[model samples]
Target: MSRKVDLVADLGEGFGPWRMGDDAQLLDILTSANIACGFHAGDPQIMDETVRACVERGVGIGAHPSFPDLQGFGRRDMGLTADEVRTDVLYQFGALHAIAAFHGVPVTHIAPHGRLGNLVAVREDYADVVASAARRLDPELIVLAQDGKLADAARAAGLRVGIVGIADRAYEDDGTLVPRSEPGAVIHDGEEIRRRTVRMVVDGVIESRNGTLIPVACDTVLVHGDTTGAVVLAQQIRVGLEEAGVEIAPLTDWLE
Candidate 1:
């Protein structure tokens, strides 16, 4: 059977007067969006605007929650407790949920942002807390993550998990991403990224940094919009997948 996957990007990552990536361009190439909530990089205006744009484009909306680390772009470990993590996640999810509701669409999924995203893949406690938060808010919400603790916990909570494949990041043999501090952790070549995305979505496997093939359960692919030439790269990835006969659809449509 031909593979089906969602093309997603992180959006609404702008603060007050400052913006990060060209969200408008990314939105045009995406089937779903992991929009930032207030705690990470979005404000009320950005969140509303982003969600509204998604609604207009028929894109699935997802809440991208993170630790309250606005200055660090949610990439720094704040060492928050379990309850803190849960409440923070719920708080962010609630804010985006309201915005999405106003835009006449539901927040279809939850993807932890930055540091929290990395931790949930490895830390059982954090993963369980995030899963609990998702279950509490909306059991039907798909949890976007790698094949790890969060994926396990979400399934355990009786929620559908959408495995997110990131083609630009280096992965370990065990399916964990290599830490950013490591050399050559992030892949920058556009052609390589496009190739990787096609392989990941069609073959259900990714080549680890050490040249080992690792099995990955990919239901969606995240195309980072913050990189240089990101829009072009995203466009190439979408084209590559389509040419490879992979169906690009929203996770909400096929996650379960």
Candidate 2:
């Protein structure tokens, strides 16, 4: 039997006049999209337009919430309390949900963005709050996260979980992603990205920055739209995965 996987990308990471990635191209390639919900990058207009594009493309819509750090692009760590985290997530999710509803689509999942996402992977408190917030808003909402505290918290909260593998980012020996400040943190070579993606799905293992193999469960693969040559890289990864006998499906269809 062929293994199934979901291809997702972060989209709608633009504000007003500035756009981050080639969203149209990425949407054409992605099965699911984690759209920025105003806190990190998107504005109301961008959110509405993005939701409409996703709906037109038959892509699954997911909330990409983050700290209220538009300046840092939500990539900077902020000291937020559990209550703050919960309410902030709730606010962002609600905005996206409303926008998606207006477009006749449902916001099916929640994936924390940037620094918040990294924190949820390791911080039990942050993970618990994010999961709890999702459950409270909609019990059926899926939580897309890496294999760690967020996944555990989502499962414990009775919400469905999707383990996401980042194709371009380098991982650490401990399974965490290497900081962008580190050299060789983000892989730019398209062939290398495609190879790493195939190995993660077929071999269930990924090579860390330190050249150590770490076990990983990949239900979905994320190709960041903002990365250089992202469109070409995504196309290559998809083709490679299919050639390797892996079935690429949408997160709603494949993620448990």
Candidate 3:
């Protein structure tokens, strides 16, 4: 059977003169674009430009919301409560929604960025906050939890859940992502990513850091657009997946 996957490019990086990522090149390689809302990275102009890029390329667009941390780039953990998460997500999503509206594009999904994303992946309350906030904004919007229990919780909350299957980082038995600071945390080898992603898409399973096989259902695959070799990696992965007969599609298309 041929495999199908949704490849997303993370867009909307930096604020003002401080730029990050090869978003333009990455957009050429990805099917969906996760644009950052103001809090974490991206100003209004950056957000508007990212939205237009997605529209021009026929790529799906989503809000990449994060904690309000420009200096830390939203990588530092803030231990925010559910209420805080709700408020933060609403604020950022609203910003991106307005920009998307201006571009005549509908925001397709919500992917939590950086530390906030990690929090929602494992923390039940935070996941609820994300789902609740999204539902409050628009009940039709999809909430991308992309990991373990949160995926189930998002679904249970009556929100459309997009599971992000392959992890570039490791995960604990409990399913919380292995902190990037930990040893053997992030997987950078191109071959490894290719192999792991194959198993995830074709077999509906993924190997953990301990070499244990775990069941995971994924609707979308995230390719970081802010990385140094992002464009190359995204291109390689797309080519590799296609060569393996895996069909590349956008998350929104898959959901539809």
Quote each prediction's TM-score: 0.97, 0.98, 0.93
Q: Which whole-number lDDT from 0 to 100 does residue 243 have in model 3?
A: 83
lDDT of each: 0.90, 0.93, 0.80
Worst 10 residues of 1 by lDDT: 247-256
Off by over 4 Å in 3: none
Clashes of 3: 0
Per-residue lDDT of model 1, residues 177-225, tens digit only? 8888899889999999999889998888899999999888788889876
- Residue lDDT tens for model 3, 1-256: 4667888867888788777898888888788877889887899989988888889989889999999888888999887778988898898999999988988889988888888888777688888778877877887788776665557676777778878854366766655667778998778887788777777777888878887887877777777776567777778778877887889987666674
- Candidate 1: list runs displaced more than 4 Å: none
Q: Higher TM-score: candidate 2 or 3?
A: 2
State the weakest 10-residue window (summed lDDT) of model 3. 166-175
By lDDT rank, best first, the candidates go 2, 1, 3
Residue 182 error, candidate 1, Å:
1.7
Best by lDDT: 2
